[model samples]
Target chain A: MADARDAEIDDLINNLDRDYDFHPGGKDNAGYGRDQADNKQQDLQKLLNLWIAERTCPDILPYDEELISTLTDRLRAQVEFIEMTTTDPEAASQSKLKILLVESELERIKFLIRGYVRARMHKIDKYYLHLSTQDTDTKRKLSDAEQRFVLRRATQLKRFYDQRFLSSFPQALQRLDDNSPILPMVDTPDLNEFVFVRVLQDVPGEVVLSNDDSVDLQKGNIYVLPYKAIRKFLRVGEVELV
Target chain B: MALPLKQIGTFLPSEISFLAENTSVSIVPRQALDVLELIGLNLPAMRPMRRVEVPLWVAIILKKQSRCNIIAPTWLSEDSLKAAYEAEASNMTRFSNKLPWEWIEVGELVLTSAPDDLACPPHIIRNLLRDIREIRQAKVRAGLKSLDPTYMQIDNVGAMELNEIRQFVTMTMNELRVLQNGRAEEEAEEEVEQYPGEDSDLEDTLETTEYSIPRDSSNFDDSLRSRSRSAAPLGERRPTSRAPAYEDDEGDEEEDLEMDESYLHTVKDNSSGQR
Candidate 1:
């Protein structure tokens, strides 16, 4: 069930996968081995891209459920292998060397996952005031776990503030979502913030950056432009932040 | 709470190098090693004297163990470095798109871990890489001098090079935007007053910076009044307190906007993002 925000990107990615030629002429061991290798490499690349995008963008992105679950399962099985296979502290030389390589890779992947989740949590916490009060479309950005986290965070903050000074104030004054005209009380992310975006495809139309500047984002060109100007392009997978 | 948003927004040096470690490099094993399934990448079995592709981190590990001889990527050779350097030196305005995004990091990594495997002497390769970097760095500084709040091209730029300027570029762009938005709203707010002094500076900035890529300079006189109204209202609201100061910056920006257009053009094509 893809939401409006990510549905286009989902379709595009699904189409790309369908168009991909996976494991052609796979009867031979070499070909089959290469196919599996390519799949794992693709997964790693996707994870890396997601990690970097989350870190670079100011707002929280939709949770990557499929990629996360698959990688977590693989991580679990690898951890089990490393744990169970070590009956003797001193194994064969080749096996020892093999285990070393596996552990190094395992740590790197773990680091990436940790960075991704932590970046999301940071955004969720900072923007909980805005996200929790927004419409359902905004709420869809959270995963089940993140949804729970934001709920508890919102409730806890409300209670803490009520006990501190907000309880003494009149009901109308206690509202944190007060649309303070000069400055927004309900801290929302600034979408207009400039970011580094790499064009993934030839963007069909022109983007009017200012009254005077407009650019046609062709495939493979990198441009530094506002995140909001290319938000749709980012969601539809036409571009990615560097 | 998380080292401030600015710090978290960009990558640290170690983090950049860590990402670079995943770059695939070819290596020849000194002894046989079995196939091993790992979480991110699957390792194929290796036989002595047979070449195989592996991540740079993995290559470094085996090289440390005297298990493999790392092969430099073709671009890391003396001829490639010389050619890249020559191209860079010849062009003062733009960067040569020939070098990969992580050229600096990869060059540093191989030089540190397996210099013996490089075709040329490590010192010569290091000097060429250094000269190319200096040239590209000069180009980057020149590009930044022409910084406008709106949009700019950054093709063929390296990951580290971008990061080095990340803090300054982002801050300047964001600040410039606030200034632009604030001035327009101020103009529209006092459309009757038109503050002859302030309005003149804003017009100059808009004419020089935004007009660089969007349209012809001939339309400047006619579009002045309409442009102010359109650029108003939707600029993150500028916090009201900083509005006056942002206006002050507009005066200084008029000089920066007078840059030649050739600095930020036509170089990089294939950008392997953050790789």
Candidate 2:
């Protein structure tokens, strides 16, 4: 059910689990205990990442329905298990300390998730037009709900423009043709221009653009190519935008 | 002509994702003690050896004082990083979620701030990090070779590397999308060639103010033209209105042909209104 987005969410979850363990491993209680701890941590971060993803890209399809409930259940079980378990003073104190860290992290993650969502909603409401007609690739960033919202908004805008602005304008002033599909006017930031990229390696390669012009990419030197020319290199991480 | 499109910077997915990222760090205090009255701290007690999660700056301060040992995040480890690199390298078609949102920066931060606390030497970790980043980047290039821009997930990646990739990927995806829809190619290829020419243009345009226009907008050229045109007796209106039509016929030639239609529309609107 969870596809490409799965890997990133899982990565964050796994990190939270592995990074927060305070238990120093011994023979009897090494891998198994750590595994349980790791799962608990992973579960929490999974939720955090899900919230973050929703907030960051509200236009994408929503997350798997069962993911949150399953994680929350597992987390609850883990908390109960921790509470019931008994140990020596050192290990008991350590678990107590570990729990605090996990809870604090959870709080921090929630705060950030809240802030991110608020910021995105502000942008979405403010630039609903930009969000609506964003190229499909960019629109993929929106969650299903957001996608629906943008679609509705796009239709409303198309109608508003068709009835009000486009109807009033003469053929010379009108941009889209009469038969052309009505998409909300796209106000995309220009992406085909040169960007400040610092070459990260020494691999020298040649890039051919739409015009069949080749630009040489030499590592350790920064060269500004029409983004079209070096789009491939940028993705491969050979060049970093400064 | 397209209604004057807004050149909003925050609209970029990369920029928004960068802003949304959580770069906060957590550290375990080395020694616990009674709660001392600190100006910002709201905590009732400070226990030794307890994990006190703090912002990156606060973590830095505590680490500097040798008061806490930074819990090197899992993504910073050699084995996990290598695994992530392999995942990224093996699949050119997709960006793996093997690393955190700000994985590169987090790894760099931990290495720079708490080298001694890590399982391996800082230099070795640095080398490993470099290898991973390079491999993943190479994979991105390989993905681009397919010409199916759908495979690229710009959101999964972040930090400095994403900035360069974002511009290209966003443009490419946008171009391919418009091409499929049979729309006019608004994705104009500008004067990115002649690196020196681009730099000179930027320098010439940017000399007037300390504020630099973002490189990603066509507005840079618009602003540049407006600056030069500021001397001319066009209207006494704000400089933001599109440059006049007669000026288009005059010596101040436009840099790109794609913007010409919009400019002409502006002229038509201005002329018709004035009459």
Candidate 3:
């Protein structure tokens, strides 16, 4: 039975990878499809269970209801989209509206999750109040109850948030293709070889260049030095050794 | 009373003859003639050398023409003057008293008094002036001393007075209400801050102590252990034992040879294991 269970687990994991088209080393590039939809749903359920386990408080539980509902609605829409795509492949091919809708829903879910986390952090401060109060039997009892509630609810909220993140990760990675690089490349210098030295202001070059043999030259006079060697020996500006 | 022509020094003989014929003698003060001239009144220039009593009719004409002296001629009898003063006072007092009350009513409804009504008629001018003065004094006593004098004009006086009182009351009430509201809001906020949600507190403590601590410590321990494991064998050059020993004739030599052989075999085994 244990072996069967292990096999089932492995199969589920394989299905998850195949359904979502998740390449462990490669970039996540899963498109909207039935298999992707199933993977997303499973991921969401796992996240929900994790969050439920984390949540300790009833009050905090209610707080996550709206978040859960929003996530569920988003997932449901994606499921419907997948079904529609399967039924009418031609229509789905022409209409990019489903993709846009999914993207918007994903963005909304992300914002909601962020807001929920912030609110939870704020509540955490309030949660400390009861613990800090004068130690009495009644107070302790109340505090214990509150602690349980918060612990349970916060855990649940975190699980849901994590699931949403996991489900959306593939889509987010695909969206990265739209991003353009904005930085220029430059060779990085080795830290150990570089050393700072003081030079006279009247010198043609303010930099004092020194080698392992203690041979020194003004940076401007070192024209024969290789670019990489010059880079190593010359300090661009004033720097403290410490 | 008739006087000798010679006794009235510098009297022209023709002027004396003219005064002597008139029964109702009008004595026009010399100041009156100066006032008439100052008012740009047209009159005959008399000789400075002559002093003459003017006829009543001529005096009346000069007085009527003069704009310099706003007061009526004083030559009239006391009874007539008193009667005229009383009539003027009564007429003015009546108009001043009635006009303000009417204006006050109109102002209560926020209506503007007509310009014709605002400009107090000639008869009631003095009374209007007195009423304006009284209103100014009242405003000062009420601590609204900075009120404009034009505020006392019939057009604005009633409304201004009403608004001033209204503003004073409204401002006082608004300030009190704001203070009260501020205090109430502060108290409510403080109460909310003090509200004790005991259950959440216990949960937080447990989460920090039981859950977070173990998880964090386990993660730290795992990292530490991995680091130590990776660094341990590198620090020591001693060959690991868990391999077959090579027997030789010399026991020490055999042990040393076994160590070297095992080390090589382990390296080979490790390489094969990696593949």
Best by TM-score: 1
Docking class of 1: acceptable
Interface RMSD of each: 9.5, 16.2, 48.2
lDDT of 1 at A234: 95
Please, what is the whole-model Cα lDDT of each candidate in the order they appear?
Answer: 0.75, 0.49, 0.33
Tens digit of lDDT per residue, candidate 3, span B17-52? 322222222232334222111100113333333333
Q: For residues B23-53, could you state the per-residue lDDT of candidate 2 as single tens digits?
A: 4566777766443211112222446777765
Give the proportion of true interface contacts each model preserves, from 0 to 1: 0.50, 0.00, 0.00
Q: Is candidate 1 or candidate 3 better by lDDT?
A: 1
TM-score of chain B of each: 0.70, 0.54, 0.20
| DockQ for each numbered candidate | 0.27, 0.03, 0.01
Model 2: residues >4 Å from true position, as ranges?
Answer: A1-242, B1-26, B33-46, B50-58, B79-98, B147-164, B183-275
Question: Between 1 and 2, whose lDDT is larger?
Answer: 1
Per-residue alpha-carbon lDDT of candidate 3 for residues A1-242, written as tens digits (9 for 90 to 100): 99999999999999997866655434554233334555544444433322321221111222334435546665576667657765786867744433443444354344435433433443343333322232454233333445565456545654675676735654423221111111001111111121112221223433332222223343212112112233323234221110
Chain A TM-score from candidate 2: 0.40
The list of candidate 3 runs beyond 4 A from truth reads A1-67, A76-92, A129-242, B1-275
**CA shift at A89, candidate 3, in angstroms?**
7.0
Which residue runs of candidate 1 sit more than 4 Å off their true CA positions? A1-32, A88-93, B2-6, B190-275
Candidate 1, B1-275: lDDT as tens digits: 43344346788877888999999999999989888888778887899999999999999999998889999999999999999998898888878888998999999999999989988899999999999999898899899999999988888888888888877887678767766765565455654332223324433433333324233323445344344323322211222222344455455234224111111110111111112
Return the candidate ranking by TM-score, descending. Answer: 1, 2, 3
